[model samples]
Target: MLVVKQALPCETVDFPLSSETQRFINICLGVPVGQGYGLTETCAGAAFSEWDDISVGRVGPPLPCCYVKLISWEEGGYRISDSPMPRGEVVIGGHSITKGYFNNEAKTNEVYKVDERGIRWFYTGDIGQFHPDGCVEIIDRKKDIVKLQHGEYVSLGKVESALQTSNYVDNIMVYADPFHSYCVALVVPPHQALEKWAQNSGISYKDIEELCHNDQAIKEVQQSLSKAAKAARLEKFEIPAKIILLPEPWTPESGLVTAALKLKREQLKAKFKDDLNKLYQ
Candidate 1:
């Protein structure tokens, strides 16, 4: 079998690509694959990684079509005065900005703003870190951040993204209750990876559902989750102490995710009420 190696410039839009996945793609394709950041409100053109940038994670500097700025989000623990770099809510302003929603002035007033200089700005509600190299990394979403019982702020989306990089995790949802000091996870393990692991660990199971219930399997999954969290440099409390493994994956058909494949968190919470209770217990 002859496999021809090909190199082409690639760019990912819409979703924020994980650092691990970006690096993997770069290596496998023998080309630098850049990730771009934008919102529908901004006409889908904001920041984009340079094709020559071999580094991973950042979405590069703001495009000339728009101006980017960071506003302090104290509640989410991201401030513009952060030591190593400035981190805050990313705001996009300039020509590429949307005018307003159709027939909804109230909704428009909430996120759309006009500065003293007559520049239009859109509050993206996305937390970002600006690097010295002029690149920006979208780290978390304001709506997805929660306060733990200890008053520590944790970004559920951030934690889930980090954990999803684990080989064992096919999908994951991080749950945090204000009544609890730590977070937990509902994970869907990859079938092939989980089966191979179970076999290596001398565990027996008729199917994925049976393997999900195995004590040793659960322990191994937890370890993998921890390893991924540590690798992503998540804080101590950010790590999920307990996890509930689910055999099924979350898809749009399951009502757990949107048509775009984004998680419908409220739906997940409602559907996994019992599993969540068990994890907390």
Candidate 2:
């Protein structure tokens, strides 16, 4: 009999995982599981999945000690009161949340403001939905949700998540040109995997650079892209119509990645604008 303890919300991005995963934990632990949503600015935990609201969908309602609100993001065309389950940027207020930046008053004031109700709200930059059932569901990061030319929303984060799971992909960055109709991506293939694939396919390459440019390699990558898209259940418009495989890996030293190895979206976009243009051509 395999025993288990608590389900750490940090363990999964869309926490609580699938229904099967949740059931397995419940059977083993004799205790229910839930997800948590919070940021560094709000200490550790500000919202938790209530036992009843412990579905795979939400991180549940706000904590007892915290007050959370969703404010309309005018630019994103999101308004809280306009829809049944309107999406908006998450703003938090409570004793547990941070007061402000220590000395950077300008930086702090930009995000933290006193609303009409006299409550100081810390803009979280995370987009979310408040359910009729009292659950708070994360939609996406406010900046990551890109609206396409036809007014379709392409979630860049969701696109990246889907592509990164492919065996041929080591990393990926999905980009949406607001002026364009479709999406594009920069894919970083694992060199070792690429080498093995080339060998099995009787293809030759002088180096990773040559391999990335080769037709066969590109074909294999496209196949992987299709597979991943299907797995992630993405719509056609949300998927990248074309991709640019990078021979060189993005690094913190190059300022393409953060110290934590996460993509610096703005920097990558600036550096690869020319390459992305080619994808459209």
Candidate 3:
């Protein structure tokens, strides 16, 4: 009796719970679920815990069967460690560890290395920190932390999550460029929802683009976003400074979004750099 919602590649009337219309039985439905972090090289399921308010972004404590540690990466290689440190790449070892990559000794040797204690540990590229409560909070991918000109870093995941909560926002991709002062969102509104709102508000639109430019429609969308921001407890920097409604939705085939639904920040920035600049100007 579990109801699971899986991320989808395209819009669907009733979203599938697994791979391309495939459905899998989810044990933690209606009940709170736990999140875990690991990699293929680590044999997966490195750490997890029961769902809790404090564990929102946490991957929970290390598993009983496995040993986990955070190692600092220097220019050439990794630094050894044992004690629970704040933040770094996650390394796993013990009974659950995988032997090595198949027929790829070079790649295998690079990720699976032994520590001073002669224990084999698989290096997971994901970046995270040990929480004060002994859980692990995944901040972002090692590469996704965008440093702004003002020396502040923004988590693109956080901003994207906030935008996704807007009812009118069907899909969105956000990015900031070296030349821009703030981030911009390429938004695709829910056309049905927008049409209903417009009709009720007595507003007429020649097309989707015109609807987006309508003052009242814009106000409604903005208000929805403002409310969603508060509800999501988004930080000031994690909210987009401005949004541009796109004529069509971004799709994998279009190369606007990745198969995992993550925005290709570099590609998007390059494609819309001019539009983003216009916003600031």
Using TM-score, give the best candidate's number: 1
Lowest-scoring 10 consecutive residues by lDDT in candidate 3? 11-20
Per-residue alpha-carbon lDDT of model 1 for 1-281, expressed as tens digits? 53537778888886777777889878875778998999999999799989899889889899999999999998888999998999999999998999989999999999999999999999999999999989998888999999999899999998998898899988899999989999999999999999999888888889899999998999999999999999999999999999989999888889998887788999999999999999888
Q: How many clashing pairs does model 2 include?
A: 0
Question: Over the stretch 1-281, how does candidate 3's per-residue lDDT look in tens digits?
Answer: 54447632222111112221222212233334345666666666777754443224456788787888776754213233424546777778986788898899998898888879888888777566676677765554545556666656666666776767788898877676545556666678988899899999899889988998787886787678768878878766666777777667777888977876667777877888887777666
Alpha-carbon error at 30 in model 1, in Å? 3.2
On residues 57-78, what C-alpha lDDT tens digit does candidate 2 reach at each position?
Answer: 5777888877898889987767
Which regions of candidate 1 fall more than 4 Å away from where they truly are? Answer: 1-4, 102-106, 200-202
Q: In candidate 1, which residue pairs get closer than 3 Å at backbone N, Cα or C atoms, i.e. clash? A: none
How much is 198 displaced in model 1, in angstroms? 3.4
Ranking by TM-score: 1, 2, 3
Q: How much lDDT does candidate 1 score?
A: 0.91
Q: Report the alpha-carbon TM-score of model 1 versus the true structure.
A: 0.88
